[model samples]
Target chain A: MVFARARRPRALYLAYYFPPSRASGVYRARATANYLARRDWDVTVFACPMDFLDKVIGSKDEELLGTLDPRIRIERPPLNQYVWQRDARDFGPLRRTFPHTAQKGYAWTQRRLFPEHYASWSFASVRRALALHMRRRFDVVVATGNPFSSFAAAWLFRRITGVPYVLDYRDSWTLNQFTDELARPEGDPVHTWERRVTGGAAEVVFVNEAMRAWHAERHPHAADRMTVVPNAWDADLLDLPPLDLSVPAAPRPIRFTFLGTVTAVQPVEEMLSAFRMVRRHADFSDAELHIHGHLGFFKGADAALRGRLQSDADDGRDSGVRLCGPVPKTEVADVYRESDVLVFLTGGARYVTSGKIFEYMATGRPIVSVHGPGIAAEEVLDGYPLWFNANSLDPSALADTMISAAKAARDLSPEEHLSARRHADTYERDVVLAPFETRLRTLARRSS
Target chain B: MTLVDEAAKDTPGTEGTPPHVVILSYADPVPQRVLAYALYLLRRGVPVDLVTPTAPSSPTSATFPHFRVWEMKSVEERHPVKWLQYTVVHRLPSGVLNRVRRVARRVPGGGPVLRAERLARRTHRRVADLVDRRLFWPVYDHVRPLVLARASRRALASIDFDAVDRVVFTDTPAEHLAWKLAQRHPETVVDGRLDREPYAHLEQIR
Candidate 1:
């Protein structure tokens, strides 16, 4: 007699950021969801609806949804906080003052009620999760977060169904990594929620070692259960051919390129100051500092950085410090191929590693590190052959490093050229997550 | 159908008396409705006074027949003597008059430098006329609200309600002038045919 194999245990993955939303954290969430579904697990994903991510965040990558596995069931329950807009027509019972304090007050109310600080996700998600669980009970749940409210949903599901659950911290919550401060004051709702959620979890996963160490130091008893799963180079972008590196027939100037987002933390002032110093030198005359990135992460935020850059450009400090704004994903490789040298700037230290570092390494372009030396990304870029560390924030030191990188980029040997692409080949995203997948399978078996 | 003619027929005009009527309005856009009303009153044997904000010789007022046009020709006292004094002083040439004017100033008797004053008034009138000609009427209308309020106040202050049998306001803004006439001389008829923009609710009379 031919006997059928036992049915696989089901898993519910809760991620506020998933496919079709081009949030910074979406890639990590997408990789987790897609990897599990492909590994023969029944993956049901609860996420922020497509329409909500588009209107509020103003970014949507509908094309990325094509990359998702068809087997996964992604349910987008109505998120209640989304209904309450920070708008004038809807400001009920609040006086309309000149400097409107209503928006801040509304944000404060969410932080008081939920650990996620600005969510009503639990309101709709818990009800939806309960109905789904009653139909077919999930064996194990893994909740990933930035809107830590998703943690509350998974926690409630586990309590109701008596199923074991795991947690994935894509970014820190209740802990501001840049300043390394305990993000909230004592007795806040976040403090109580964090303690309760961590106490009940089967396992906790962090994206970087610095974050895990911070969490471990804060709550040592749960330290043994935590594992680090750092973000890696996008597999899709890895195979693109390197620049031909032909000397331009009539190159306008040497382009010291910085591609990606120009955030508040990326040290824009230091980069600009350093570029001005490098352009002052006779050898680097007619140098154009090309910055190809979105001015900020969100739409409205771009105006401030745009204005500052424009004002300085108008002042004529450096003749051609161009802010060549965001390029399409298809054009990103072309932007890399065009530049002589690359600038890698980050605002995070120890705990923060930007995903751009992997792509930067893959270009084999001499990268002048504009970020502080202590950032977690330093460890990744340290071994690359063409790397130039701007050891201090001083413009002169950065200028010296930038000049050396531009010169090296202009005159590259074939062996030295192969080094950048060679070092980055090892950290493909799928390779980074392979061990994490095995660990997840082990967790599922132990629970069953 | 004319109110003035019908009234004249019922209560015959006395030999020594003429039925007095006054019409107040802005001179801009010719105030065609107000002019038509005044023309009807004149045809019915009523003496009409048309108050022109600028010089009375302005073409809008001059075009009307059988009506008196009163203009405040100088920024002087409203009484008759100041108008007399203003006209008498400005009739002379200013080249020699300036020397005499400086002497009069030192002697504490410079009576407001009417020549210079008249020059300023003439300059203002010319500029106002140029503005009315060149600017789009709506663009020129920016100052009309304040001008409308002032015109209403000036008409109320200077007109004698006892002499005039009725006050006719053909524009909306002159509603204030009608109210004042009603308050000061209850016997005088106060009538404004147009709807006021500011007191639009009052115009909601069905």
Candidate 2:
């Protein structure tokens, strides 16, 4: 007898960066898409077109397209209207006369005309979401943000179709993490908009408990709806075995590899200073500080940021600090396998959590955390047997931590390494996102 | 090595080589189109080399050995105006002049000179902006090709213009360079982006 399984409820996901565009937020959106799809939720992803990502943001990783589950549906909305371009030749009449004035005009329009800055996808995204909802009646709507326009679109969908939406914060909106200030003044448009969106949302998802708690405290009325769903490492990417650290110490260079975007907030200059100190005193002269990531986010900003890193990489002449350049998502495993110690350099704080840390944890090698004290990173690296936390941002302290990490790399027992890897297995994408996925399934069913 | 690399190695870049093209791009990174076009040209027995400041971050496996990449001055070096443009693009605060003047006066024993310096900087920016708008921009546009061509001539010192059959530009900024190169070698067929797209158009599909 042939048996047919019941169809699961459908979820329409609104994400500004998805497959083809390797914006750091893409992974969170991908996780939501893949996790929901795997749990039999008929998922449709509203993603930014590849051309917009290629021409405007200038960083496109089409390889990410292959990583998506075939069961999912991806729709490209109209996002071409508000792409940022610095070329004066491409400017309008007002922009041509006063390029500086034109920039101010963009900021004004971003605040007054539409909430989405430089992202022209709001109208098109809303239009598409409405048409799709009318055609098939989406069970639940989900939107992830930092181009918080996706949330604005999701809110529009809720207003139109009454689809219970989940608001996921890949990064905080209206709350600046670096300065710990409100993104704007207390009662500005962004503040009002965020409050309205949160109050309307069925559930609000955050990357960490810190963010979730922050939002919960701010909007106590929607406290029950707020939940923390950490950005976990994709298990598929970690198919290769972690580098075995139990082998005999060799005089060869100990690769202290860091694989993530080298932004100012990550304390790259501080790390460089710490690295230079370690090289001098700790006899880590042999240790190669391999930085494998892009210099900046946009195409226009790349050269300026690269100029800073060029000095650190000693003008790409292969100093001890080497700028390895960015590697494809597929080649990430090979680089991990080659590294001896993983350097977790981040703006470590309660509000911040780098997904790279989970990927770092997956690699059983010793990790030296070169970031300020933060609960989110601390919680994740809690029981890591060979993890070294830098007590202070001081170069000397970080050097000592790096030395400790180096020592751990040389002297860890095979059992200790295996145990660390086993602990990371619990924090895999599937492991972390499963409960959140289940909650969404329940919400989708309830709405249907 | 991959098949593309193997093919590139096999292809002969002889002294008296067949007609070839050099695609010039000054500011922007290598777009996906250039990579595709280069590979297409290579496969069609046409030699193509990309002259740009930086290479594409994620090139296809096929692009490895197909075309040669010639580096140029970075955007920061080539386009110094843009460096200053981004820094002070936004409107200066209404009280900025007054605030600076006050700070200058408050500085221990160094008020007059600091205030004078601040006034000079403000005057310099205003004059520069006026000149940039009225004089430099309009004149620059008309003679852009000549300017870029002169710049390219210096940058491509090693390149043999005699052997190059075509000089192509995938974007607007480098079109002048293409035009300049085309003039020096009348025999060279220039596929200038200016002829096709005089102005940058939005990619908005109706």
Candidate 3:
């Protein structure tokens, strides 16, 4: 007599930006997928097409694709590139012949359907999921979104298949995190879509408590299932060496490093101003402020940023500022090691908790925040022994904080370093994700 | 020799080295950010050509040394109807009115003729403005992309598109030109974003 083998519980993850597409939210999606796969669940990811990654965004880190767990399956759904298509040659016959009429039709589709350019992709995702479901049933679905189309796709798939799904809010849909205002005004279809998607979700996950609270106020019915799963530093990517108890205790030029993609929203000008001001002091006379990352995510933004960084004094000959350019993900550990102090430059207040702070804290190095007061990241950095919050964006105040951070970097005690490292240890990818994974497992088992 | 050749001859160091990237800005008021990106490319040892409808008025040739600026108006000039509409329609009437004024001064008791000439010129100006607003502009708005496509094609003839590394669409209007270029050289990288990271990958592959 033959006995049927027990099947592993399956999860279908809908993420518009996944591996090889170097968008900011990919890291969280990658970690979530990898975590699920490791926990003995069969995971499949639905992501954006290669053409969108190659031609539309022109930003891809192929090295990241190699790091994905082999057990996780990835599917690319085609996006109707009517809005993003810059090359006229690729347009359809209708668009080519009657451009104005085609635009009207496209706009009508956006208004009638899911109000996003990726709405077609969401519909395509649902169709793809339904087809796959017919062959072999998926126990649960998990969708992470910036395109929020994925959330709508999951909702559609659940309605059709009666499958339970989780909504991972890597970003906000209606609330503008930067200005703390409504991203879309009243009567916008996006508000309706968000309401329906949240109302139906089996579980809703947010990156921080502030975001969770904001969404909970709007979605009180789903508030019980809503949980905060803060973004944690990936151990596999960093591969940081065991912390050394012995301090360097050497008198040398401090390397104040700011490592991340520089964007317009960040206080880059203020950071530069503070760095230059600190350089005038006797203790920081030879200190160098090294900016190591891509200038901006958007094409042509780097030029404006570079122009902004250009100094008036003899083209910054003696400014002690260095543009170290972008370091690959694999080599990021070395950058963290070489830095004496880390500059946590970011934008957004209460609702924003940047992913870089985890990596910065994990290094056990002194961190100096250059953002506005009351940033949600302060919640994580609250108890970190070496954290030096400027508390304001004023350049003079930030310069004073930088001086203190530099002193701490040079004379930090081994006990304090170990304490900071221990604080960061709690936020490790596996550590922070353990509860979320258990919840998924329980949901899958209950559904089965 | 084409305008590209003349531009290369003017810049001594860039005679043989063709532009690695072509940036198209089809809007009248080109964004300063786009110009900054072009400047950034030049600083990074990358050759650049800027094609635009209206060049910046800040002495860009002196500021952005070795940068090539190809005016889209030059292409519009090649079309006789557009030339008549742009140059002759506005200028010829004004010049004739001025000449009538000059001749009227030489004639004895020419006040009535001068008044009549002024009235005729005013009527002509009003009629010309009405025609341009109602007919010419609306037609041009629809046909501008097609005309600019030809201008971009003409501009590309000077450069080796096969060797060109990137074709960036700086704004919405430039998408038409980008589409045309993509059709001709499907293998080339035609994109909207002029990101520096992808070129690093290209360099690695090389």
Candidate 4:
């Protein structure tokens, strides 16, 4: 019998917000992990256990977890910063009184002891992971971060294990994308630490071209190592049987659905005003703005903007703006299926490419964007034949755009909607990650 | 001569008495000098009191025996209105002088009003520094009791200026403030950088 050699490559995936946690960042992390595993990679995922219980986002998708490859290993280190009720023994009396504050204090002490709080975990994880690598070495260590702690961990592992690492910046560190303020001042401990860590990283991946360019400007010597990897829709998640628009029982009054956390950063007030103005000035007077997501999540704290949203909802009672609070992620498709128009509300500087935009594209519905001009989302939505762009925040302009987009939605033919869906075909998650896989394999070969 | 020798020469005291030291430090990080000295004195059984700005981020207390670290809020944190005034006046760009001159012409008092404006502008730098120090001294003043209470028993009290010393102070010129503090508190005050070397041994005392 002829021997069949295994084609799979081993890779370590570092994500602090991996599922079954529901942090908004989880979608991209999970998609990356699943995509890599499906491509015959022995993907090992490292995450914090606290993500599940913090309820910053709640867990869904037990079904999705089942779909991950059998060989994919998920290793969770008990995060020192977060205390699950299950890990009560890990805490002291101070932790019980003010958990988040205690966690911060503990993290401060840890950082003082080690260069980074996560370095302690990295030291232990790298030791164990290296042992595995010696038996059958990992081709790549892919670390995605918001904590930026994961990047530090990856840097430590790269030095110790001699494994090449790819630093995926879901958001930029050092350079503030919004205000362009330095996130950490020069000579500050964190700034120095990030400079040192990023200097040695094998490759740096950014979500948008602007972010890549910004990092490249800062680290001119490492310019060639930086790459742009935009977020994309997952084809497997969108493998739902074709939605029939001719069904008689669909919701009336043309539902305008917005799914994701409603935060201060997003122009929630502008969205409410535009919807109200649309009702006042346009023919779609009965159109309802249905918001299906959490207001904000952190220590179960209520955001001041959430209260403002509540007041705006009350103000819009005569108008048809309804704040239908969060729906589970599994039922997200059903929410999308019933909607006539999708509302994309995002905040942050021009470079922010939010994950919701990808899911919106996959829905093949008419999208109305109420944001600043030159935003990365506008670049993604530019070619969609049925897309409605309102590249301004001025209330009257947004109002007019909303009215126009509603008219466009009402007039869409079946053929036009299909064409819009076809445009998004290239952006499927697996297709986006294919080049990243090749990059990792090439780096693995060069190093080995 | 060493700081201890100089202090002994300046103010004669019994050889048996432990040195009394007053330290003025900001409340941000625990002043490294005071911590080293306190650890040194505690090991030597010498009393020490550390006067510092109050901890902005946490609670402070007399945690170590023979060594008490007192925390006080900075003057700026205490006086919000005065701090705002200083911030606005100090940060104003000179390019706005023409704009101010045009506005002054419209006022009831014209050129004399502008002369008074110029005089106020001339003194603004000094006035801002004085206000900052005055408001900030409450934090400074509160720690004095803790210093006196702890070190009063010592036969000779030698102040360590490094505790609250600022090198590049734009608020108040460093030399003027140093000379003023030294003149006012002649008995207890000492030069910070000058006295630093002798205390370097304190790190190894324990």
Candidate 5:
């Protein structure tokens, strides 16, 4: 009897911000691709080209390129740099000849077609996927977005090739995560695309239960197909030290670290105010607030964010609020190890569950939340032994929480730290990705 | 104290010629802000040349040190069409009409007749203004970048392009001039950001 060898399921992953492009969403995209590849799936990722990462966004982490799974095939479809190009000398012939008309045409296309500056990338992504699909059929298409254009590309690929596609909401598109309202009004191009794309997707994945429920209520027909695959800390990337009771904790000048991209949406003003208030208190008088990450996603945003961090009264030295510039992923574990307490500063109240929270919890240090109450991340932090929630944005209230967190950092039992680490263990990248991988496998099998 | 005095105080002992920065600000409605940037470069020991569509209306009496203003309007007016529009169509006609009206004012029993003629001419001028704004200006503005780019070469003849280390663009209209400058002098750094400190870049080059 002759037996046929089983063919590995192929996944065409459309993630514009993938490994090497150190955008906040890139971690989740990287983890997903790596996990799928590890689980015996032939993963092919369509990501942003190098020029877009290196020149346009100007936030590339070369260290992250090495972290990607070797089995996964990566393709970077070219993007139209017309809108982002700053130098007039770099302008194309069409834009150079008729600048106003060209701008108007691009604006018109965005208004009518896909409604994103990265919309051209989506068309190119679809073309590349289709060409690849013709040579060797893909069993499934999985796409994540902020350039929610990737969802449109996945939907288009499904329409043309009849492949099952999953839409992963690493960040919300039509809904404003911060405001918890519709980002676009009714009948906007974004809303229209969201409807059509959600209607066609085989499965819709959200980072948190709040976001999942929000979309489920809006997309009732597709509710059954929706699932929550919470963002997890990369175990491969982060080497968190085990909680040790043998050595006594350091007593003075506790480090309160916030590890993530500093965006305008974050309650930075309140966080700073609380830190300043904490410094005034005798118990945490010498506490330092070290913000270790890129100041906004783009290079241009650094100066503005730096200005905000540096007040005239305090040039960061007197206040002990140090702006530690971005550290590579490999060096992140060192930042975590050196810090006594972690500051969970996020923007969105109900819907946002930051990936940094998982990494923060994994450190086994006391985690202080500096955001508004009822954040979806609180769902994960609920069982954490060392978790400290401010419960409000008022500086006084947040200051009190920071003091409590600092004390916890000094006095919390090794047992308590271990328990917190255990809570984080469930959110290790592979553990969180396992169920999602099974779902992808099932989808791929159904297509086969 | 004057900006020149401040520049002199800031850079007391510069050994050699500093980096020459040319600022192109054809569309900056406020020339004062461009002056501020020029002042910043001057204070940092860098010489600045400002190219604008028009001269600053309210410059201080105190002469600014290591600074020069090159008005492109002078070059733009040298264009045949613009020259005709300014000297012949608008200036000569209006001047001749005003002279004729002054002579008519001296004539006996010419008061009411002159008033009627003045009212008719005012109405005709209003129509002409409307035509210039509505019909002619859009096409003129569309072709203005190319014309300004051509004019910039002639306008900026005094400044040594080879010695110019930086070409700063204040706005979109200035981009045409920057683009032309970039083509001719590829080595000169062209940056749109005015907030940047020129000294930082100078340090990097050093």
Candidate 6:
């Protein structure tokens, strides 16, 4: 009797920012890639060497890297775009002639070129990936973008290979969420390119429905292809031993934790103002806002923003605010466990859903949101128990919200805490990505 | 090219009035080609006002004094959209036009009328206006004359024609504009060369 050989599903995962580099976006990309691999799909991840540069966000958990199925293949292409202090070996003559100017010039070039820098690198990376793909065909291609150039590369690859490509927009392109400026004008070259590429995509995925709707309205013809796959908390991260919730004989200072990069886009001014208001109004003189993140990545130019944040931390120390620096991914749970409240400060008013929000939810602790009202987190945290929602950036309102959340932290019952944890369980990373896996399977089957 | 280059060569700082040249282009840093010419002239103590299109991505108002950029309006004809639609929709009979032109040249009484018709067809006023409207050529037409006038007044007022010896046209677009301006006002026209085209001459001037 002749037996038929079992077929394996093939997928190419194009993520510019992937694991070992602890950028906040890496969690979702890592989880999605692993989840796809686990579901019996042969996954090939294409990323850059530049992703792991600097002490920007250090990697901690090698265990998560180990968890990736051995069947999964990883490919790294040399990225010539970004310049970092860690990359001293490659500096060569650049380090000799104009050491300080080299870094600044590199940054200036990146900003001026914007999407083109990555697009230029994509030419080489895609050529190499395509050569491999021709030998062993990929059934489907999934491209996630923050740089947006990854999507362009995938789009080009799909055009060349005739493979169905899915665009995963971690953040919206064309729409500037912070200032509401059209990122590119109608006749602009980049806008025209985006329209053409998105026009041909098999599917387009966004973090939230608002972003999905925004893209849909712009590309009405491709509206039917849009999908929403939200950022979610890792099951392993949430599976840590339950924290001992019993109040100490004498309560230590109330610790508020923010675990992400602090950049100019972040509403740092509002956060500092709220902290000051809380100190002025509330009797908790010992309260501290612990910021567990680096200031900014871009070198000398970002120094001003970094100095301002440092000064805010210094000024707040008199009133008890501390910038605890960055914690690794492995130690993030410990940071959450120690914190009395999670301070959710984010950039952009609407359509912005930060990956940290899901991790914050899994902590089952009281969260004070100091973000815009119509943000995606507002919707996610709506059903969340022990969440303090401040409608605006008003310091007075934020202070009041913080005070209430602080009080909730002090008066939390075990039963209420368990309910909060249960709510978080639904948004586990595996659970959230399960639908995505099933969708990929369907796409693979159709292609086969 | 040699004459223009020689004219642009700088002399030692001898405290003489500089020749002022106005550029009719984008209202940013004068296009690099124009800027290079301006710099060469500046080294020789010649002042310039680089008038340009008002909607420059990054205006150079503060950076360089000679880089005076601006925008203006002009009257031009407009074409019907139907003519464009016809051009795109139908393929022209390539051999018919060629054969007809040959026949017109050979025929007894057809030569002059055919040549006049051909010239008239090529220089369609409505078509030119349509092109102008679609691609914003009125901006160039209006601004070019103003730039020439301003530069001429500055040159004649401050320095001798001998001292303000050359007005180098950058390249095709600027060179073509310079050609047209030179036809109307010969006094301002200097050495003409298409060598200093900026942005690798991606920009084509009709």
On DockQ, the candidate that comes out on top is 5
lDDT of 4 by residue, B1-206 (tens): 00122333433123433454544443346545545544554555444555444442222234444555544434333354434544554556333555677789998768887886687667765765775577644443433333332332231134443342221111111222233345445443433331332333333343
lDDT of 6 by residue, A1-448 (tens): 9889767889888887775555567788888888887887889988756444443233333545665567778888766633332222223454323333444566675555444556655666688778888788888889888768777777888888888889999877788878767987777666766787788888899998888988899899889999999889987655555556675525687778788878788878888788877777545656788888765643333345655665655533374667676565667788888888899989887788888888888888899998878887776787889899888888888889998888888877777677788887788889888888888888878876
The 10-residue segment with the lowest total lDDT in model 2 chain A? A82-91
* Range of the 10 consecutive residues with the lowest summed lDDT in candidate 2 chain B: B196-205
| Winning candidate number (lDDT) | 3
Model 3: CA > 4 A from native: A1-3, A245-251, A312-316, B1-206
Deviation of model 6 at B23, angstroms: 32
User: What level of docking quality does candidate 2 show?
Assistant: incorrect
Alpha-carbon runs more than 4 Å astray in model 5: A96-98, A185-187, A249-252, A281-283, A312-318, B1-19, B28-47, B56-67, B74-142, B199-206
| TM-scores of the candidates, chain A only | 0.89, 0.92, 0.97, 0.88, 0.97, 0.88
- Tens-digit lDDT track of model 3 for A62-101: 8899899999999998899998775557777655544545
Q: Write down the lDDT that model 4 would get.
A: 0.64
After superposing candidate 4 on the true structure, give the runs of residues whose Cα lies further than 4 Å from its correct spot. A1-7, A55-64, A82-90, A93-120, A240-251, A315-319, B1-206
B1-206, model 3: which lDDT tens digit per residue? 00112222433224454448888887777788787777666665566778887777853667656567777776766776677786666778888899999999889999999999999899989988988999887766555666677766767788777767678877655666677787788876677765564333122210
Error of 2 at A92 (Å): 8.5
State the lDDT of candidate 1 residue by residue for A233-283, as single tens digits.
Answer: 776744567656464435457888888878877778888888888888897
Every candidate's lDDT: 0.69, 0.72, 0.83, 0.64, 0.82, 0.66
**Stretches of candidate 6 exceeding 4 Å from the true structure:** A50-67, A82-115, A246-250, A299-302, A312-317, B1-206
lDDT of 1 by residue, B37-145 (tens): 6656555555677754544333333454546765532322333343343343343333345566566577654566756655665765565456446653344243333
Error of 1 at B17 (Å): 55
Report the error of model 3 at residue A351, Å: 0.7
What lDDT tens digits, residue by residue, belong to model 6 across residues B12-81? 2223434445444422334666556555544443445543433344434454554444442111111223
Task: Arrange candidates by TM-score, descending.
Answer: 5, 3, 2, 4, 6, 1
